[model samples]
Target: MLDVLSEGFKEAKLKLKGKAVLNESNVKEAIDAIRKSLLEADVEYSVTKNFLQRVQEKALGQEVALRAGKGDSRVAVSPADHFVMICKEELEQLMGPVNAELNMAVNRPTTIMMVGLQGSGKTTSTGKLAKYLVNKDKKKPLLVAADIYRPAAVQQLKVLGERIGVPVFHKEGADPVTICKEALQKAFDLGCDVVLFDTAGRLTIDSALMQELADIQSATKPDNVLLVCDAMMGQDAVTTAKSFDERLSLSGVIMTKLDGDARGGAALSIKEVTGKPIKFLGMGEDLDRLEEFRPEGLASRILGLGDIVGLMQDFQKVAEEDQEAQALKLLQGQFSYIDFYKQIEMIQKMGSLKDLIAKMPMQDMIPKGANIDDRELTKVKAMIDSMTKRERIGQDNLDRPRMARIARGSGRPVKEVEELHKRFTAMRKMMGMLGKNMGGLLGKIPGMGTLGQMNNMRKAASQMGQMPGGLGGMGDMGSMFGDSASKPKPAFDREKQKKMRKAAKDARKRNRK
Candidate 1:
C-alpha cells in the first residue's frame, strides 16, 4: 500500500551507506529523499514536514555504535541503520503510542456509530467490523442500517450481514435517527452486546447531514463513534476526519480500502489531524479482512521490513492446526503432491501471494522484472488434480504415459508436468536435508532436549522456513535462500578433509601436466 514510501526509505538507506555517523552534512540527502517520498505518498504537507523534522533532530544527534567483525568482516552499525532506526521510531510515534481498543459498554449494549462521506466504504466497513467483533471478540453484534438516504444501502447491509452470519436491523422508510434509536432497543431485546449504526453520508460535508448524524448520536449515545475514511482519498480523507471529529466528536477512525492502490497518506495523516486514534483498517472487501490498526506494524511495513508478526496472525487465522501437522510431515520428508496441494490451499486461505510476499523482510531479494502471479499456484493445483491418487502419493508412479495423460487432462504440456515433478522432488530433497541439519543442531544444544521431543520448536522453525521460497520456488523464498542446500558439501572428517585436499592438489598438478 505504501510502496512509494517503501522505495523512498530504501533510497534513503542507500544514500547513508558507508557513512559512519548521521551528521547534518551527510544526512541532508537522505532526509531529502525521505521528504520527497512522504510527499509522493500523498501525506499531508504539515505532517510530512513535522515527521521529517523529528527524524532529522533525532538522527543528527544520535551516536553510532560499532561492534566486532565476523571472519574479518566489519560489523559496525552504519549511518544507514542508525538513521533508519530513528525514522522507524519517529514513524511509530507519529502513528501511535497507543492502539485504540474498542470501548464496549459493560452493563449494556455498546452502540458504535459509523460515519463517513459517500463512497468511503462505510457500509462495507460496517460489515467487516461486525464480522471482526463476532469472530474476534465473540460479541453478538446487531448491524443497524441507518443509511436510509442512499439507494439500496439497507439491502447492501442486509446482504453483508447475511454473508458474515450477523443479523441486520433495518426499518423500511424510517428516519435514520429513529431507526438507530429503535435499533438500540432491538439490540437490547435480542440480547446483542453491540449495535453498529451505519449512518448516512454525503458527497461533501453539509450542515443537514452533520445535524442528522448529531441527532442520531444524541439519540443512540453510541459507546464509540468511528469515522470510516478512504485511504485512497489521501489528504481529503484527513480533512473529512477533522470535520467529522469536530462535529460528532468521533471516538476513533477506521481507514478503509487499504488493500487497494492507495498511497497510504490518509492513514498517516488522519490521526495527527483529527486527534483520533485509528482503531481498524479495512484491508479488503472480505468480511473478515478488517484488521486492528497497529502503528508499529504499519511503520515496519512502510520501511520495507516485512511485518512477520502480522503474517503469523494471518497464518493463525487460517491453518494453525494444519500447519503444525504439515510441518511435521515436511520435516520427516513424508510430504507428497497431496500435501503440497494442501499447503497451496493454506496459502490461498491466508490471502493473495503478492500481499503475503510483501510481508516478508526480503523485498529487495525479489529478482528485478519478476512478478509473483498467484495464478501459478492455481495452475500447479490443476496439474496435481489431473494426476491419479497413486501418482500424487508416489512420485515414482508418474511414468511417461501417466505424465502425458495427466498433461492432457490438465491442458498443459508434458514437459511442464515433468518440470513440476522435477521441482517437487528437488524441493522434497532440500527440505529433508534442511530438517536433518536443524535436527542435528538442536540435538547438540545443551538442555534443548532431543529433536523428536521438540516437535513444537521444530514446527516453529519449519513455519519460518515455509516462507514464499521454502517449498522450492513456490512463492519467492527460493529467491532469498537459493538452492545452496542442494549443492554437494565437503566432508567434515579430518581424514576425509586431508584426502579431498590431496585430490584437489593432484587435480591441479594433472591440469599443469
Candidate 2:
C-alpha cells in the first residue's frame, strides 16, 4: 500500500544521499523527479505542486558542507534526509494533526448522509458504519434506504439491515427526497439516536445525481456527509472525491477496498486534496472488519509493523461504552476463574484476537505450526459459566476444596481451572502495570508510539506470552519466537478470507454489466 509513493521517495532520497556536494542543478533535478513521482501516484495537481514547492524551497535553503573523513569527503546531512523530512511534515500537515472519527451525535438522533460513485461501497459501508455505531458505540441506530434509482439498492439495504438486526426505512417506487423525509420521521418516532442514510451513486458525477443528493441534503440536513470511494480506483478516486465534495460538501470520507492490492493512493491523497478526514476504511465485507482511519498508524503499516493503532481504535470505540468500561475496570485487579471467562467474551467483540495481534509487531511471538487457539475461547467461556459471580470476580473466594467443587460443577478438571486462574491472575497484574507505563514506554513500541495516554488495554496481550510459562503450553513456542523460523504455514479458513476476492470479482462483474 502506498508503494508508489514509498518507492518514489526512496529513489529520490538515494539520488541525493551519494553526492559529496549539493549544487543547484542536482537539487532541482532530484526535486523534479520527486514531483513527477507524486503526480504519477494520482495525487491532486494542486496538492502535488504545493508539496514539491515546499521541498524545493527547503532544499535550496540548506547549506551543503563537506566533511573530510577517513578516505574522502562526503556531503554531511545529505539532502536526502532534508528532503524526506520536509515531505513527511508537509504530508502530515495536509492530512491533519489527528485522524478524525465518525461524528455521531450523542444527543438523540445522529444523522449521516453517504454519497459517492456507484460500486464505491456506499450501501455496504452504510451498514458497516451503522454496525460500528450500534455494536461498538452502543448507539441505537436505524438505516435509511434513500437510493431510489437503482432497483436492487433498496433491497440491498434491507438485507444488510436484517443481517445486522438494524431497521431500514424504505418504500419501493418512492422518490429519494420523499424517502429521506419519511426516514427522518421514522427515526424521530423510533427514538433512534443515529440515522444512517444510504444515498444514490452514479458511474460518474452528473447534474441529475448531484441534484438528487442536494435535494436529500436539503430535506434531511444530515449531521454528517461521508463520501465512499474505492481505494483500488487510484487516480479516479481523487477525481471522484473532488466532484463529490463540490456537490455534497462532504463531512468526511469512507475508503473502501483497502484490503485489496490497491496502492492506497486514495487513502493518502483524498484528505490532502479534498481537505476531509478519512473517517473509516472498509478492510473487509464483514460487519466487524471496518476500521477507523489513523494516518500515522497507516504510515507505520505501509512501512513495516502492522496497524496496531487501528486495532486499538476499534477497541476504544467499544470500550468507551459504560458496561464494557466497567467490566475492564473490574478485571484490572485480581483475576478470578470467573473474571477470566468474562474477559474471553469481551475480547471477541473487538475482532479476531489472533488476527488483531498478528497485525502488530508480535506476530513472531506465537508458537510455530500451532494454530491460534481461537477455538479455546469457547472452552474458557464454558469454564467460567460453571462458577458463581463471586468466584468469577475473585479467585480469593475459591479455596482448594472450592476449586474442586467449581471444576466439578463446570464439568472441567481441577488442573484446567487452576491453570486458567494462574494465567488470568498474571495477565491482570501485567495489564495493570502496563496501564501505568502506557503513556511513556508502551507508546514507544514502533507504530504504537502516539496513542499517548489513551493506549488500549488490548495491547497487553502481546507482552503476556513474552513472560515465563506464558507460552510454554503452546507447541513449538520456541521456533515461533526463535531467530530462525520454519516454513509452511497452516492454511486459514477460505470462507473467512472473502472480502478481497469478492471485491475483485464484484468490480469485474460491475464493469462488465
- Global lDDT of each candidate: 0.81, 0.70
Q: Give the CA lDDT, 0 to 100, for residue 409 in model 1.
A: 96
lDDT of 2 at 197: 85
What is the total number of backbone clashes in candidate 1? Answer: 4
Model 1's alpha-carbon lDDT is 0.81
Q: In candidate 1, residue 377 scores what lDDT?
A: 79
**Which one wins on lDDT?**
1
Q: What TM-score would you give candidate 1 relative to the actual structure? A: 0.85
Leading candidate by TM-score: 1
